[model samples]
Structure formats: C-alpha cells, structure tokens
Target: MSTNRRTFLTGLAAAGGFAIASPAVLGQAKPRVVVIGGGAGGATAARYIAKDSAGAISVALIEENEVYQTCFHSNLFIGGFKSYEEISHRYDALAKNHGITLARARATQIDRDKKEVVLSTGARLPYDRLVVSPGIDLKYDSVPGWSKDVEEAMPHGWKPGRQTQLIKQKLDAVPNGGTILMIAPPNPYRCPPGPYERASMFAHVLKASGKRDCKIFILDPKDSFSKQGVFQEGWEKHYGAMIEWLGPKVHDGIKSVDPKTNTVVTGFETYKDCAFVNVIPAQMAGEIARSAGLAPAGGYCTIDPASMKSVVDPNIFVLGDACIGGDMPKSAFSANSQAKVAAMVIRGELAGARTFPARYINTCWSLIETDDTVKVGGRYEAKDGKIAAAETFVSQPRESAELRKENQAENVGWYAAITADMFS
Candidate 1:
C-alpha cells in the first residue's frame, strides 16, 4: 500500500480500538444509535442500521418536518415544469416499513458527555451513537441590510418548501419585460451549481411567457462557477441578450440591496426596480449542530473520514452539508454517498468488527436549459484522517442530443431512486 493509505488505515484501526476500549471503561449498555434530521443522510443511516443490525442495535430518527421536499428537482417547480407536490415526500414509509422509530421533533442540543440528544420539547433521547445530518442553514446576515423579517422582500429560497414557492410566486408576479436579479453565494455552500441552474430555469419561464424583453442578471461572488462555460453557451444560444453575469471583480456583484427602495448596489452603480431578487447567502451547518457543539470554528462539523465521527465528541457523527469532508461539495448526492460510508462504519464498530477502508462517490447534475444538461462526478477516499477526491467523471462542455436526453431522464430516475431509498 502507499504510504498515505497505510497511515490512514493505521489511524482508523487505532481509533476503532480506542472506541471499543472506551465503551468497556465507560460501562455503557448495548449500542443504540440515534440520527437527527431525517433528510437524505440521516434517513439513509437509520434505515441501513435498522436493517443491518438485526435488532442487536437500536436505531432512532429525529426530524422536525413531517414531509421532505427535495431540493434536487425544485428548479423544475420554479420553471413551471413541475409542482411542489411532485418533489415532496412523507415519512410514513420510513416508519412503517423500516422499523426505525421516527421521532417527529427538532433536536435542541446534544449532550456529548451523556450521549443524549435533547429535543425542542425538552425530551431527551439517549444514544450510544449519534448521527447528525441537519443540512445547511442560510446565513441571512452574510448580506448586509437583509434579515429574516426582510425575507419577504428578498427570498433566499435555499431551503426547500415554502421559501421556494414564495420565490416562484415573486417571479410570476413580475411585470413583463422585467429584470430578475440572482445573487450567488461564495464557495463552500450547498449545491455549487444550484444558482446557475436556477437562473437558467427562470430564463426558461421568461421565454415561455412571451416576455422576450425580460432579463436575468446573475451577480456572482466567485470568478467562475460550476459548468460556467456550458451554461454561458446555453444562455447565448437560447436566451441571447436575456442573461447577464457579473463576477466579484464587477463591483463585487451587488454588495447590498435596499428592498424598500428597490435598489441593488454594486460598487458605485445601482440597479433599481428589479422585479425579483433571489439572494443566495453564505451557509453553515444547521443550528442544531451548533447547539450540539458539533460544528468547528469555521461553522461546519469536523469528522474522521473513516467513520464520519465528530473528532471532539466521538459518540456523535455528522454528515451531509453539515460535515467538513475534504473535496466533497455539500449536495444530496454527496450526502447519500457519505451516509453509506457512515452506516458501514457504525455497523462495524457496533458489531466489534474491523472498520474497513471505504470510498464515497458523488455526482451532481444541473440543467442549463430544457434539453441541455451538465454533470460532474468524483470518487473520494480517506487519507490521513480526511477525505480526498480520488477520481472524476465529468461531462464535456457540449454533448450530443442523445446524451443530453439520457442525462435529463437519468436525473429524474436518480431523484426517484434516492428519495425512495430515503423515505421508502
């Protein structure tokens, strides 16, 4: 084995040994794992543990929302191609079929010393192991002059459900030949390609509505974004003169917006009377993670790649957008991939078996236009206590009609499979 690989395996073995020994010293009962945030990662972990443990280990899930509206296909709703109901799912299947106790409550805090999760209702759920996938929480303050109360004026729509509908409503209410301003957040946010895809979908709506004069302006914090070249090409071909992008150097791309005045300030220039403003701000792990003392100073939870366990509190493991996994962008696909790895590690540790070196894979697909799509995929491996991309499977700038059609179809299929895997 390579030097780095050898070192990683050795460290994992040592950590596993320490975990096993510590239980004996601590005098804990049979292992019971509790998972928080029953979205992609938490749901997957709960189902896998419940099925794989064979009743030897207990598994429980906690979530605030009874229904989950996936963010993956939410852009379709914005584009008027699909309804919100199409992307929403319930937890009935998880509770009835999976044999996992679904606690419909928000986690208030995690007592690391006692290994217990405190709920918002003041109920405490004890666990031998805790898995958190609370996902991303919007940093509204990241953009000056914007607060939660001002959300009605400028919707971030980062989270799924009502916020998405509100943004779509705002778009639909805009006058014909109006301008839509989309502000993309900085790096290390949920779904790197989401903002661009959203802009494309909005443009599609504008074209279909016969608003030929309507334009979508993207104010981006980064110089370049995912599938930039392909998205630009699609915009030029499909919505010529209707789409414009300004990067950081372009006056830092709208430093602030005064909702009442209907003005967006970028350096010395001001854009007034924009119909809709979709401001995607910076993101961090959900408040639950921060309350649980799981997040690091940088506002994300640090975890050991081998087991996805929080370094400070070994009993707790965090995944999805909340985790700081090297080279893994926070996306539903990446969360699903990491969930499987986390499940295997939890299973092995609880079963007193050796934790195997594992690999994770993530593939993110973005629709530039109705028939044009772009994708990027990669594999990650644990190295020296952190995860690193081992390989990539990316789509080219331009694709054949057949390939584009295949991707579009596959995107739907993937969504179905993943959501089913989570709730069903």
Candidate 2:
C-alpha cells in the first residue's frame, strides 16, 4: 500500500469509536444488530456484518417487502431496456449465504430510549446497534394541486414498484402526436440525474415507435440539472423537436394542475389534455426516519462522515437517501459504499475485527440514446467533520461513439455489480 493508505489504516487502528464488545471478554451473548428498510444500504450492512463477524453478531433485516424494486434502473425498464423482474431483487441470498434473519414486517417505531424497534406486528426487536436506510418519501403538497390520492392519475415513479409500472403504462398508452408532460422535482431530491434520464427514456420509446411527432415537455423547477450539457445535446441530436424543456424562469413555475382533465396551468402557457403526465413532487426522508427522531427540520439525519453514525444518537447509523450525505448524491452506489464503512466500524467494535479508514465513492450513469451514455462521479472522504470531494469527473459533450458505447457497457455492469453487493 501507498504511504497515505498506510496512514489511513493506522488512524483506523488507533481510533476507538465504540468500545469493544467481544462476548468472550465481556461474558455476554453474541451482540445483536437490527437493520431497517432493506434496500441498498440496510441490506449491504446486514450482510456484511453477518458475514464478517462470523456469528459474533446476530443480524436481523426488517423490511416490509420480501423483494426490493430499485429506483435506479426503473427508467431503463420504461424505455424497454429491462423488465420489471430484472430490476427486482430478493433477500434469499442474504439469509441463506450470510446467515441474516429476514423479517418481512414494517418497522413502525424506533424506541431509542429502550433500544428497541417496534414492528407493525406489535413485536419489539432489541438491537445492540441499529442501522436505518429508509429511502425518500414524497411530499405531496409540494406541488400545487397534487396530492397522494391523485397519484394513480398522475404518477410519480420516484419510489419504484407499482408507481414505476404505472408510469411505463402511461407512456405506452400515449398515441402518435400525443402530448406528454413531466413536472420535475425541486432540489436536493433523490437521484439528481434521475428526472433527466426518465425524460430521455420517454423520447427514446416514442422515437423508436416512429411517434416522432409525439411532444414531450419537461417543466423543471430548478435552474440547471446534473449533466445538463450532455443530456440537452443528446436530445437535440437523437430526438430533435420531440422533447422540450422549460425551466422555472421560462415557465414562471407551476400555477396549478387539473388532474381530472390532464391539464397543467403555467404562467407562460396552459397545457391541456396531456395524454401522459408524470408529476414528481418535492421529497423528504421516509416517514419512519422522521418518526425515529433521527431527522430535524430539514427532514434528513446528519451523520458522522467517518462512521455513517447519526449525529443525534451515536448508537444509530443512518444511511442512503434518509441521511444528509454532504457531497454524496442519493444513489445506490453511494449508499452501498457508505454501508461498507459502517459495517467495518460495527464489526471492529462488536466483533473485535480489523478496521479500515472510510473512503466513499459514487458514479451516476445516464443512458442518453442507443449506445450513448454519460456519467458523473467522484471520490469523497471525511474532512473537517463533513464529506468532501477529493476527485471528480464527468463525461463531456460530443464524445466518440465507441467511447459512449463503452460507457453504456460500464453502466450495465455497475448495475449488476451493485445489486449483487447489496443482495448477494
């Protein structure tokens, strides 16, 4: 290893974030860890803790759903690149291979004072340490005239699963020369690049079906979005005049929506009888996380960058979209990377295992068109009590076809690798 790597390892060895809880030394039973919301972060943390501890720690993964549907690649499914089953994963591998106990029940409450998790079934689970990775939840009133009840008519496929399927069906039902509208979410939401990719998917499907006349309009609330240069360039090159993006400055923000008539009233223009509409409203941390007192008024938990432990309660770790990950965007790759650091720290403390310094990395890949993909990524480390970017890179505009194709292949491979890291 290099000198800097050695220094990091030395620091990890010298640090005692949590007291060693070795059962032999303390004359106690194996330490039990409970993880909530088994998606990207929770699943990986539970599996790593169980596998690394080698029965020194008992792990329970409490998730309401037996199968996890990923929000990351649901856009590809909409574009007909993947199927619903392809993006779905099960917890069978974590249980059979890593000895993780899977509980298919929702966690209703987090009793931090008692160090217990109350489940929806009225059972309480005790944890020596708790890991929570509940993902984003929609703020229905964030959009004018939009609420949870009208989601079936105007679907926001942000959470994945049935909503994702609903959006795909709406896209498929649009006729040639039909109008499709998407109200993109505001800042600091889950997946900075997701809304743009979904728009690309919409154009891709319509263009493929020779529905080039079908109009796709994006009413964006933000001034600029992730990878705006490349995404806009790709849209002009592949699906010219088929997609139109109007920022807040141009549209003067959304005035109201008539869900019954599939209409949107904007300051500049009123779009009526839109064949398809996707209204992704503002979002916050999931309800369970807020209820646990892990979040403040910001609706996200501040975590210690070195350990992914919640700043509010040292005994609890918050991961994924629920935590305020300074530089790391809310993505599966970021969550999975953070989980490794958390698992190592938990193992080092409770099982007396070796520890390593935390290094977080993330790359968000967006597929623009056939064999055309772009990505933005960075390496982050804890510095001055917060995560900061050490190195970063993004794909430039008008790249070579061969290089873009390679990037697309990389995106596909990463999806496979990350899902395996989380579930298997």
Candidate 3:
C-alpha cells in the first residue's frame, strides 16, 4: 500500500459519525467480539477492533492452527522464489500485543440462538458480535471419483500448509520428461490467477532444472480465465510448447479420475497413466458457515455491501472467501480490505465509535517467470445495495521486460506489506 492509501484508511478509521442498526449489544461491560479462522480477514478484524477500541471491546480469535500458511504466495514458494517459513505467520504477536484472546481449537457449531460458538473441545464462547471468516472448503464430490480420501495421491494444495508441501515434494520427485496434469477448478474459486501462475512455476522449475522435455497439461473447466491473453503470451514466449491448456470445448467434461493409478479421464481423451495429478475441485464456504445456515443455497453467505454484515443476522459478519464479495475476486488482499470495513462497522455498532462509508481495494500480482509478473486490480465501493467495481486495471500484453520486472517488485513488496497488515 502507498503512503497516500495508508493515510486515507487511517483517516477513515479515526473520523466518522455514521451509525447503523445494531442488536442489543450496546452499553455492555466490555462487549466481546469473536473472530473465527484467524487468516487475513479474521486476524485483521481482531487486531483492528482491539487497537481502535483501545480495550473498550474484548476480542477473541479462534483458529485451529497456531501457524498460518498464507495461500496468497504459496505459488511463489512452489516455484522456488520463497521459503516455507517466509509465508508462515504466527499468532503470538496478535495475542501478546493486541490484548486479544487466542483460541486454538476447531469451531464445531455456531449456536445463534444461544449466541455462542461451540468448540471441538465442547467449550462455548459467548459473543456480542461474531465474525465468521473460515475461508473455503473443497467440495469433494464436485469431481467425479475424487474424494477427501484421495487427497494423499492427488493433492489440491488450494488451502496451503501440508498440501502445499506435499505438492512441492511431488513436483521435485517427478522424473525428467514426465508429464504433469492439473485439473483446474471452476469459476468463483479463490485466487483467480492461481492455477495458471502455478503452472508457470512448474514450467519455471522444469526449465531451470534442465527438464525442458517435461510437459504440463492444464484441463480447465472454463472457456477462458483471468488474464488469458497475457498468460498465453508469456507461456508462448518463455515455456515454448511445454504447457498446453485444454478448455471445455476441447475436454468436454471430466469423466473420472483414478488417484490410485494417477490417471485422468476426459470426454475427448483418457489419460490412462500420469506421473502426477493436481486436482482443485469446486469450493464453498467453510463447514461451519454452511452448517450454521448462514450460507444460502449458493453455498456462500450473503452480506450487506456497506458493512459486510450478514443479511440474515445483523450481529454476525462474514468475510474472506466465505462471503459473496460482489465484483471482488476472493484474494487475500480483498479479504484484508473487507476486514477493515467490518472492523470499523463493528466498532461503530458496539462501542458507538465513528464510522465511514466502506471502500475496498485489491491487487493480485502473479509471477510468471524470472522477474516477470502480471497483475489485475481495482477499487470498489458499495452501490445499489451491492459492492460494485469503481475503477480497475490489468496487465497488457507486449509490455517491455523492464515494466514486467517492476511489476514483480511490486508483487514482492505487496506480499511483505500485506502479511504485516494481517498478522503483525
């Protein structure tokens, strides 16, 4: 973020007088704010509430994992540009410095009637306001003949952590001239450019390792993807004929996938044998969100655009990949941006703190090759009862190498800055 943007957000945080509807949460003795998932959205919301309220609000963050492996730049790590520890963030700082309670246990249920979150250990946490940001969950049955049990053989690496490491290890173990297949997810998934960037990283590894004979196949369910022209241009320029993308017109549909034999079956062709297969199935909001009836039939929670409050319940807010982020792609930066708005709004409702109109910004920078990156971003605001795009930009093809290098620098810088914004 630039100094101008930082100053603008700080000003918004400091000075505002608007008030929204609230439950009977006002004038409580240190009203509790409970945040779940502790990723970009949860952590930022928790920190901002504790900091801005100056201990007037008690914040509790519930995350099952002590260390969070960010999914934002895991592709870069797989491509050898980053170390594992570099993307991992710890919650010790959040607890010690922010005076927030950290709960390290799986949240099993959201008892809206009782106004409590039931943990896996059978403990209940009462809250005046709840922020559910559990991120995404893969629909195991979305892919034919694939299930959670098959993840060991065919890993998605979508949510990061061990799956990320497993995919990296598998990539390293592939023999020279071997073929790798990736089953791309459908639209409305997290990280719009992730799969293609990962494919570029795979090619980068092969080209660097003198394994140019290896081939990569991306069977995408969509006709086109984000930054299609630029990605295709870069692949043709750098990877030569090493990568091939088969769209729905060509693949027709996925018949089945046999993880036991490392095979993928498509309508046009059946890959009877493959060295490695990475399948990213369809996704939905996390288990707790769907189970709590907050998410509608579409498998994502609906939220008021201005405050990010759940449409069904004013006291509950949903953030990150779990909420229907109209006109916004589900990126870590977007989640972090939404978190701040939710924090400000929650404070306005609970502590009678000042509030301002919500504005969100997101920029997704994708690394294609060495010092070669591309990006797509925008600024958004609430309009017509929905969060709509106000301004947008994307990388263009035939750009100078120097400009691409500059974009890569931006990618690195933004990653460092946003990690601190979320976890520090």
Candidate 4:
C-alpha cells in the first residue's frame, strides 16, 4: 500500500473513532455501516466510505468469498481467450490496508426494526446505515426440469468461479467439431449482451481448434437482444455458419432441460447429443436482500431514486443489480456508477446535508470476437419520480479495426482501474 493511502485511512479511523485501544474496548458506540455482498457495487461503496468518511462511519463488508472473480470477462475464459486467474481478485488489501472489517460470511437476515443485520453464524451487527449489493441469484426452478441438482451436469456459470471452470472444461473435453448449446434467459437479466458475447467467444475457440464444423447454438427467449445489429454483422463476417441463433418465435427456444439425458426441449423441438450446455436461468436479487424484506414483488429491492434508500426501510440503501434502477441494465459498469452516486448520497446524509436527486452513468462493452468489440454508454437522470436516460454519450456500432482495438484496450483499463479503486 502507498504511504498516502495509509495516511488517509489512518485519518479516517481517527475521525470515525473506529480504532480500538484494545480488543475489549472495541464494543463501544460508533456509527456503524454494514455492507452486504462485496462485489462491484458493494466493494466500491465500502472503499469510498472507508476512505472518505474520515472515521465518521465505521464500515463492515460481508461477503461469502474471500476472493472475487468477475462475471464481466468470464466469457473470455469460457471462449479460451483468458485464464481464470486473470479475472480473480482478493480482499486482503481492503481489510489490511483500507481499514475495512471484512467478514467472510453470508448475511442471513435483516431486522429493520432493530436496525441490525444477522449473519448465518448468529452474529448480529448493528448499523446506522446498511447497503445491499449482493447482485443476482439464478432462478433455476423457474425453468421446468432444471434444479439445483442438475447444476453439476449442465452449469449456468453466471456468478463466476467454479461453475465457469466446469463449463469451460466441458467445452474443452468435447469432441472436435462438436456442438455447444447456450440457453439465454429472458429480459431483465444481468448483462444484456452477455450470452451473445459468450457465443462469439465459443466460436472463436472452435475456429482456432480447427473445428470449422463445430457449431454454437444460442437458444434465446427474446426475439431481440443488445447489440443485435453489431453481433449479427460480426457473426456473418467472421463465424458465419458456425454460429446459430434461435429466437423465441422461431425455435420456441428452450422451456426446460433434462440433465439426465443431456437434452434441451423447446416447444417446437428437442435437441439431443449436445456436447456442452450453459443454461443461464432467470435471476432475482441475492438471498440476503430478499430475506431482509427489501425486495419488492419483482424480486428486486425498491428504493427512492433520490437517496437510494429502501422504500420499506429508510436506513438501508440498495444499489446495483439487487435494486431496481428504472430502465437500467444490470452491468458491472452500471453498478460502479450507481455505487458512486449512492456513496455520495450516503455521505451527505451522514454529514447531515440535504439529499439531492441522483444521477447515474452506464457504459457496457461486449467483445464479439478477439479483435471485435461493441459498446454502449448513456447518462441517466431522475425525472418525474423515475430515473430515465437523459443523454447517450456514446452508443454506436463498431466500424473500424482501430476503433475496436481502442475500445478493447479501454475496456481492460476500465476493469483494472475500477477494481483497483474498490479493493486497493
């Protein structure tokens, strides 16, 4: 850690009075802030609060994993373009250097009336303000014949880590010129262009393996998808017949899957003998959010747009994929932007300043091929009691090779800087 960062953290601890003279003396009163789910949104919020609060807020971060592997570039790993280690990060820096109390445990429930969070281990954390950003959990039971037991046979690989590796291994072990099946969920899922990008990556691997006959079949519930025009053009120009996309109206898509037989059944037909399958089921807010009574009927948290505070409980703020941001796609970039705004709002509230309306920025990039990338960016403003897109900063199709390369490099730089800002 840098000397400047250490000095900043020390000053924050002194201001917040979080540093204890001894372990026994640590049980005194303090303005506690508990953050659930240490992913992009939660981690960024925690880092900012710990760094900028100047000891006025004591932040505790709860996450199940000690190390986090990003979902953003996991498709590249599946496509054989990158390794798992390339996208994984540890939280030691945040704990040891940033003065954050990192708890590696799942949050069990929230007692809103008591202003406390209960962990699975039975420890209760009292907080003046709480933040939830657990991301999404797959709704496996939504799709008939697909259950948690079938995960070993056909992985979703949506949340990153071992499931991702399992799918990649299956793809690698498949026979040359074999077929890979990808089941894409409906709208309002994480990463709008993710499934298509996964398909493109798989096609790249097949092309490199001398398996020109190999095919990637995308069974999508929606008739249209993000970056559709750019993806279609890239597919035709690069992979051509190697990639097949079946929309809901045409193929009826996949209603269910039989893991025992390795068969995917659509309303119109059934596919058999699939070498590998990635069934990305529908999603909802993480379990902790739902348990806390923060989630609404749509399985996402409802928050006031101005303060990012829970509608059911004012002391709690929800952001990122767990919260319903009007008309915003759930992406890491979007999460980071929301975190910054939420942090600012929370800080102002803590400092006893009047809260202002929130503004957000979103930029999503999808890598169609090794050298081909597509991007979309926009700014959002809260208007008429709902957040809406105010301006499109950059939403265009990829045309030139130079632009694609530049976008790819920019995407990498963004991943590095954002992650560093959060954990480092």
**Candidate order, TM-score descending:** 2, 3, 1, 4
Q: State the C-alpha lDDT per candidate.
A: 0.84, 0.90, 0.90, 0.80
Candidate 4 per-residue C-alpha lDDT over 1-424 given as tens digits, one digit per residue, 9 for 90 to 100: 9854664455455334422333232344456789998888899889888777767668899998988999988988888767889889999998777689988888898888988889888899888779999999899787788888998799888888899888788877777778788888887888888889888988887787887888788988888888888888888888888888898888865667888878889989888888888888999998889877888676888877655778888678898888888877788877887887677666655643233346788888878788677887788866655567888744355589888878888878887888897789
Model 3, residue 219: C-alpha shift (Å): 0.4
lDDT of 2 by residue, 24-81 (tens): 4235578889999898899989989998888889999999997889999899999999
TM-score of each: 0.94, 0.96, 0.95, 0.90
State the local distance difference test value for candidate 3. 0.90
Q: Best candidate per lDDT, number?
A: 3
Evaluated at residue 303, the lDDT of candidate 1 is 91
Specify the poorest-scoring 10-residue window by lDDT in model 1.
Answer: 21-30
- Tens digits of per-residue lDDT for model 1, 19-127: 6676652354567889999888998888888877777677889998988888888988898878889989998888778678888898888888887889889999988
Which residue segments of model 4 deviate by more than 4 Å?
Answer: 1-29, 353-357, 393-398
Model 3: ten consecutive residues of lowest lDDT: 14-23
What would the per-residue lDDT of candidate 3 be over residues 221-288, giving only the tens digit for each residue? 99999998999999999999999999999999899999888899999998866878999998899999
Clashes of each: 0, 0, 0, 1
How good is model 1 by TM-score? 0.94
Candidate 2 deviant stretches above 4 angstroms: 1-10, 20-27
